[model samples]
Target: MSARVTMKDIAAELGVSINTVHKALTGKAGVSESVRAKVNDKAEEMGYHRNTSASSLRRKDINLVFCLPCASREGAYFYRYLWEGCNRFEQEVIDQGISIERVEFVVGGYADALEHIDERLQVGEKIDGLLAYVPGDDRATHLLEQIAEAGVAIELVDGDRPHFDRLGASLADYSTAGSLMAEQAANLVHASGADARVLLLAGDPYTDSHYLTARAFHNYLRDHNVPWQVEDLTGAHAQVKQLERELKARLSSSEAPELICSVFAVGSELVADTLVSANKAGEVMVIGNDLFPESALALRRGIFTNIVYKDPVGLAYRGAKTLGDYLLWGKTPADPVQKGAVEMVFASNVDRYCKLAGI
Candidate 1:
């Protein structure tokens, strides 16, 4: 019989140390994704099989930290769903030697939250993995680097920092969602047999998702030769009253847009309400993002033309699951950036979504 292959043999063949091979095989931190993939492929090629009895004896409890926004924070209604999804994942893996600790910060307070985590790591905390929503800022990036250096695997949620050495990310294809909305807008205008002015109300320009969605929306219109004059307003979703006033002003203007596309859920609601208040609900077509109770109601009443659902619950669930599986099973995700499904909901199918969401 052929001799059993070993880590030593695999390491020698791959031109790497046995420690690297061990880290890859055992699904521990410190190995890059590329090296892990190579090590795994070579181990399988050489007929290497782990000693299950020894591995079981050496296994230890995994500690995963979920660093996200507090559900009670301003503009955090979507975060509540993310929290629920993470809790669901934790429950499923409670008996499997894995534990999840949830850490929250107010919206726009990611820098402080991440600094606290960095302090913990500095004090030698044994954090195996982290599922978080990292903001794009210099301080946050530096802290993330330090945490990664301490050998904690990170799986980002909502958005991705491709420059960071994160295990993976779970987020919506925002560009696609935006393009879908743009396509729907084009169809609506085409059916009307006239050129229409369009307004795009986008959220914080610094947010990757919001930026991508707005960019895609504009690009689609330009690429498809859609003869619509588009005016994009950035940072228009920061406050309810502010958005209301802006929408009211736009609605009251003589050159009010024939179509309005809001990439934020609250912005969509405010636009619908303002249009109704101005008695222009029938004069404008509204396209929005997300499927919440208020947005669902607007769809039913024909105040909203269509909505692009980003599926926050699904994104959070997958992010947590990916990090958990990586820590517990030495399994790497199939894609470095995992994208959740985006759905387009209209009045015709809004009831089905409302029933699913229990709204």
Candidate 2:
């Protein structure tokens, strides 16, 4: 099937900037009459369907609130990228009569943040749309319901609560990531032609992403008939010191796994550091998740075998844009869950990813 035509596609075909094409098509005053005619003619030739609903909405002001974890929180490495993406999107749409206000809370403080949002709504604050990384907790669910009932459109990012009637969601496909990591691990084990035990540093089981990743990893190995015993080191990502201690203990034990896998960015560096300290850096194969300064360095140093790169920045940007489009153009995402792209990073290509990630 042919894809829907977009302003970008039109601009590319006409050798013009997207902004110019947008102005011309939208009948904005900046575009010259000649250029507007050309654009309109090309749009018609290309079967562009103008959205009358969106045209009306573009004249209205939009106010959106972004609720997320603060960068100051420990183990917030991933959230930092999310913030960057959100800010980038904000800057891109700054001149479009759209206002994005950020509301940051400490990690694991969703209830507090939701309560604050509820209070603001009660005080007659005008919120056209809201984007948040809401977890599946009762208090969060209750507050989210209240906010939705208050006529505020909501879009979830990073995680999702399926029961909630949200506009849409932008989430990482952690199950696919986990399965990819498992395949990499199995390939490495097969290449060595030796039986090896695997340890999965699975972050909090309650979190949907973490739980799905861990389950997929285990299931993949089992389904493939891989002869590897998988063990889990389960805990919240924020408990850095505790996780480190537990990992260190396992590394020093008699039944220490030969392969270590981390499905999240939180403790990937810890895993590499512990392996280096225990003099098992190159001896044991390590599969990490996400690409940042630390993990990139670990990959370059041969301490990490591979990294399942979950593009958090892209996820956040897409999520914010999804909500923005819904508010400004009356457009809805085709799917309820929009999964961001994932990549596999190795030493040979880690530098390229690092540069792309602005690390």
Candidate 3:
């Protein structure tokens, strides 16, 4: 027998470092597919098999788990695109013997997600790393901490808050995007040549990303010498009737703000609908988040002055890759705080953005 081939023996035969051998066996990022194939062939030739027993395993294999938010009927499309991104990354590393499991929960169900996590652990499927779409809740944050209490890496996508003591996060630069959107809003207001005030629409106060963007928009409006007012549409995002009622009430006010800025996807859709239905679409300059179907159409028709599009797929792909790098190769992402590229679309460029984004 070849003297019980060890990692050193494999490295010597392949003329590569022991680290490369380890990474290949674990299906980790960093090593190329060709090198991994060479290392695996040699390891198999030496009759070396991976040890996957839960206890005292010499060979470590990574198990990357996912927990994504699944919304109800109305917001399901939003989650559909987010899942598309996650699935794209999932397909890339699926053949490497690393198990990837995705646990889903309802739109705003933190308790459901935690229960599902407990149920998953009961099946003895160990988690080396987790990539999840974080929501705006303190309990869910605590649940994530508990899941990773055993030293598992946690990578957050779409939304991130390192201050909550998370290991890493991949998302778009909301604060900066907000500032850019503000500049666009200012331009639209000035070009309109009216006493247009910004009617800032924001989601729940706890939604850090949306809140940050609203703050930036408000600050920029103040700095640019424009007037603005805020309407808290936090819980009403998924509520159609409530959203319409609130938007209608605000629009019918004595001094209605002609410039509407929606800071979230659902909010944007609702705002777009209200403006179109009221036939005031052209009059009110709308600046908002997301490029969902409604918002895309609204932007295409010049109803939405500017639509800020965040790369959903990029966030998921990068978050999954980050976890793979950390769990498989013991490599931390060079930038732990990764942000997706933000694209700005106007009526003049909506077609190009739509074609590129496949919306």
Candidate 4:
């Protein structure tokens, strides 16, 4: 590493007083624009402005709250990775005197999260920043606005719901992922020498991620001149049996679908099970999203054409680090909207996702 460049060194290089350098760097009134510009340019050239971490240590330790969904067995594997990233980030900044508190939305939706924050406020707790999975809708928006009013910076994980410029987020490009899945499904249909009618199983209605992905997938199929129909399974997450019956009914037609694409991991698993039970696993092409362990196993078993893998762990890690940057040093991400990387997993590379899940 290069020797640490100090404000003193900047002042020396510019042949000015240290006070002038400080004022210029800090946007104070004492320095004239010409001299200020000179000092600023010299400081930039000399790499002198990264004392923020040390400065953070001089201030009070940061207090942040991480809010996320915690359900029974549903979405548990995904949340495990999100928690892993949060825990690892917590350890990374422990020496810097950063404390992260976790608050789970255990029983319900954003309303439960709102109650958690409200309870914190009731106890006179001060939240410096919040790193959470804020849903993309009015309820979450209204609640997040309330939290913003309470003077807490918000960082979104996996999805951006509020559409606020100041809100920090690290998520994946599900739109592109949707198109990729569509492409795979279309190719499978073409290879089968069958008509391109498909069953598109969508996600929860309240989830903008699912809606966005489903829309993109449908658009891609339409643009490619493929025929498909969508059924929004909003209650599938909570009504597993109902979802099963509905899926069975849909796939029970005399003219079997040549392809099936689902926006959610669970949706894909259900389709796989239904197809196997109906003795159509080899007859239909099933394309699914996410790297849930079951989905990975299915991909390896060739029940799935390919599983779209979005790095949720990476999203949580970056989201935590971004919140840390803002809370500890008053820094914001260069791009307020951060997106996660997406990949495709099949039999050839299902092992990578298995190791990621530690299964």
Ranking by TM-score: 1, 2, 4, 3
In candidate 3, where is summed lDDT lowest over 10 consecutive residues?
51-60
User: Per-residue CA lDDT of candidate 2, range 290-330, in tens?
Assistant: 88788888898899989998888888899999989877876
Compute the lDDT of residue 277 as modeled in candidate 1.
84
Model 4, TM vs. native:
0.79
Query: For model 2, how many clashes?
Result: 0
Write model 3 residue lDDT over 105-215, tens digit each, in one string. 776776677657755655755667778776577777777766654345688887776654455798888877788888887787677786766677776567766788877
TM-scores of the models, in the order given: 0.83, 0.82, 0.77, 0.79
TM-score of candidate 3 relative to the true fold = 0.77
Q: Which number leads on lDDT?
A: 2
Residue 268 displacement (Å), model 4: 2.1
| Stretches of candidate 4 exceeding 4 Å from the true structure | 1-60, 162-166, 227-234, 357-359
Candidate-wise lDDT, in order: 0.81, 0.83, 0.73, 0.74
TM-score of 2: 0.82
What lDDT is obtained when candidate 2 is compared to the true structure?
0.83
Q: Output the lDDT of residue 26, model 4.
A: 67
Q: How many backbone clashes does candidate 4 have?
A: 2
